[model samples]
Target: MTGTPGTRTGRVRVLIVDDEPALTEVLSVAVTEAGWHPYPAADGQSALRVARGCAPHAVVLDGMLPDLDGIQVLRRLRYENPELPVLMLTARDALEYRIDGLANGADDYVTKPFSLEEVVLRLRGLLRRSGAERTRADDPVRVLGPLVLTARTREVHRDGAPVTLTAKEFDLLSLLMEHPRQVLSKAQILDHVWSSSFDGGGNLVEVYISSLRRKLDRGRAPMIHTVRGLGYAIRPVEDGR
Candidate 1:
């Protein structure tokens, strides 16, 4: 985790650094599911680059890297922002490894193959301690790539053009925006947007989703996507694949 002025964008940004591509993506998705922006880097150099641009509130750092070691990265990050919270992830659970990470400035430690839920909870705790936690419900504006929505005004925009949506459509779209990049099952969508577990809720979700796609993606790159049996997710077109 590191900070330099002029990088924050009114959202909690987390930096996830790991040499493994799959692990980095998983961590990024988990952070997004928590309603926070995630910046993923596959190596220490890449991590430093991202931190320079995002001013992340917290970091999930892998203990080993292809280039610099995790402890070295930790030192550089601390030099930039001593208050930034870091959750270390190490494949080696040896006592010395744990002590080294903590002595280097890690706020928390988690061994690899750890529970995703536990990592998220630990990050949340670190954020709370650093005065970086904020309720997503309190943010009236939601942004996903080129799409923007203002909850207070009930306004939706795609590339600066006003988009018209009905009450249910707005509710569903906002729910997706609230958890960008996170796949939401029909059951979850039903409970959150329709406030029901009725048998028809699944069909209702599909119908509204279709309508949203038609209206929001008329002549442009699609943002709303279906994930087959899993349900649906909305992401920038480039990343949807």
Candidate 2:
């Protein structure tokens, strides 16, 4: 697979690791469709080599590798690139497998028989959360009172103090700040932030919102307001009217 510059977004390189050639080929196509370049590897060693060479923004790693187990590979990869987002793909559905993968530093995990569309969305979410996806240099820095967000720098400050956030938290807060006082539905948030259409059967969005409030709203009037049965919004402390 060759790296092609994206028409709309910057080129994002993704390493697809799987022993099955057929799966690798299909994943390469999916990666391309998702507007990313794919670097395919059949074994753990090959995966390491490709990762170092391509400097992929993310990786989809198979759990059961022919050369090394997924956990080992994940640890090795983390050592090489601690911030690189990795999504583990495996047939194992056991709770222990999931726990082990997460413990080893996988950014996300998916079982076999998963939807290709879902996989693409997960990859997109990972990229967004890790600040790997490029944005326009001219994007404006949003400011609502003391809260400040510079999209280009991926920096957020509250009351002139630097506030650190994970990739996902930063994206979620940015979306809310972009549309202050406007209630954004769960579907809208998931679509814009996670890049997924997964039904709101999960509380992932809510969890992130809660953490954002804790971090960004602490020692100040809450800006993140949850509209019951509607969604959430960021607004000034006064003038609920």
Candidate 3:
């Protein structure tokens, strides 16, 4: 959807790659309401065709297609526009698949049966951040332990190595890192990372947090913490704990 009166200058264009006509229509309507232009592609080939022609700011891609897989689509897009932001949609819930998506250069992934609002929110955030960096060229990088976030590049690094994070995980990490050692409630996280129309019973945030812990906290100094009966925080691990 478009922002406010003064925020409507250039429209954010999105190319959706999915074989489901019904889902694509629904997404198109939602994206239109959110002030974005939506281009639909029913298969991987069509997706690439549309993407090449439109050169969208972002893409919403499905994992499965009749001809080519989502990974192939991602590969082509990377070849054509390496820096293009992609939001992959898949029904697979397996951790391995999610990891594979990241490994293959997907900017973000949303499982099937998702809320339209969540999708729109993610698109907006990605587009906003993408453009925001150009306007704030002198912003300093944010660091937390091994993690390094560059607002200019919209890139994250862990120990000098590039790390891929979904939109939600990046948002959550940014929030926690902004207030290190401070507890943030689930409600707060929801409000910050998701649109108000999100209605997943808070499970969505938990799922993404688990994903982040696996990717960002494994074998590390345990920066992300859970406060019982309260909320969550990210801080350096105590010497003994």
Best by TM-score: 1
Residue pairs with colliding backbones in model 3 are 1-34, 1-35, 2-34, 2-35
Q: Give model 1's TM-score versus the native structure.
A: 0.55
Give per-candidate clash totals: 0, 1, 4
Off by over 4 Å in 1: 1-9, 135-241
Over 154-181, each residue of candidate 3 has an lDDT whose tens digit, in order, gives 5666544566887768888888777767
Put down candidate 2 lDDT per residue, 106-135, tens digits, no spaces.
989999988889999999999998877765
For this target, which candidate reaches the highest lDDT against the unseen true structure? 1
In angstroms, how far off is 181's CA in candidate 1? 18
| Per-model lDDT | 0.82, 0.80, 0.73
User: TM-scores of the models, in the given order?
Assistant: 0.55, 0.54, 0.51
Ranking by TM-score: 1, 2, 3
Pairs in steric clash, model 2: 129-167
Q: Could you give the candidate ranking by lDDT, starting with the highest? A: 1, 2, 3
lDDT winner between candidates 2 and 3: 2
